[model samples]
Target: MKITLPGSKETLPVGKILCIGRNYAKHAAEMQSDVPGEPMVFLKPSTAIVRSGGVVVLPKQSKDVHHEVELVAVIGKGGRNIPEDEALHHVSAYAAGLDMTARDIQSKAKANRHPWSVAKGFDTFAPLGPLTPADQVGDPQQMEVSVTVNEETRQNGRTADMIFSVAYLVHYTSTIFTLEPGDLIYTGTPDGVGPVEDGDVAEARVSGCAPLRVRMSRELD
Candidate 1:
């Protein structure tokens, strides 16, 4: 899939979307999950992306779908075994994103020791905003990230709360899979994730970046 960025006539082709899980201690506690000694990783396909102002079609298979607002790092360069100090050099931009989840499906999958891809990989599960060039984003870890549903605040936190920093996540993920241009890393969410009903408009934001707004809808029969 291709994504259009602001101020740039060129569109970037999306590659594998790597995500970090339980990177926020409060979020982990809310989910009843223990804080990991290392970054917990996951994957979501490119098809999951819904650009800002898009609609998130809730799957019929899930009874409870939750919203997770996150800070997204967009890779501009490719490398493997990168050092933490230099990892930020590989990022091209930053965006506010939502990692929508089928909580019911995810709970069952966890109970059965199954992968979370099925619960997290549905089309429209990932909603992203326009990119703010990396140079334009100041001190990513100091940014405030938040989410609102129907104009009511649902999540409000800071990137500083992350158990794993963006740079460290890049360095660690690259060791396992070769990082490539257009690849995205979802840096995980904070506490206060909850269910969104049909027609609910969810907006996610990160300081110094455009806000990502999306409406939730039920799958049509």
Candidate 2:
């Protein structure tokens, strides 16, 4: 099974995963949901990832597929109930990532009050960076995160829009899940979420961080 890639040599640091939902007010409302009073958390099995410059295999179950641009943080150490100022200390690295979603399936599951695992967690659903060490990413709070599909900017946002600061989520999440050295957390996405068709190019960038360019294609029949 030979695969083609631009940055195949890049090795990503692994860790327990945390996903923040409804962190961005515009995104929350676009999905017809309210801004969470607190952080909305979710997870993507690490197995779902396809590193940067890799292909995003569009699933056949796709009624509608969409891309969510997010800021991903890698944890260096495990800590519980950490202080906001202290949150920076736990970060090992950062990367710009895409939380690709099967929107129609997700909506159906939500309507039935079912779990999002099947809808959100699938092979090759999470496409990530070209990692940048924490030292390389300064002021994680003020970076620009943007996503474009087929050369058009679909979603553009800033980390400043996050309802729960990184420190808050790090502290808030540790209390629930025992974070490990290899765990990663996807901070959350902003407004302008939409569909990704096969042959689409999904390019993402984090200001002052590296750029990620991925060309998406449908999975083999």
List TM-scores for all candidates, in order.
0.97, 0.91
- Candidate 1 deviation (Cα RMSD): 1.2
Worst lDDT run of 10 residues, candidate 1, spans 3-12
Among residues 3 or more apart in sequence or in different chains, the pairs in candidate 1 whose N, CA or C atoms overlap within 3 Å are none
Poorest stretch of ten by lDDT in candidate 2:
1-10
What would the per-residue lDDT of candidate 2 be over residues 103-183, giving only the tens digit for each residue? 999999999999788777877787877667787778888989998887789988999989988778888888888776667
Candidate 1 has an lDDT of 0.94
Per-residue lDDT for 193 in model 1? 95
Quantify all predictions' global Cα lDDT against the true fold.
Answer: 0.94, 0.81
Q: Pick the candidate with the highest lDDT.
A: 1
lDDT of 2 at 61: 81
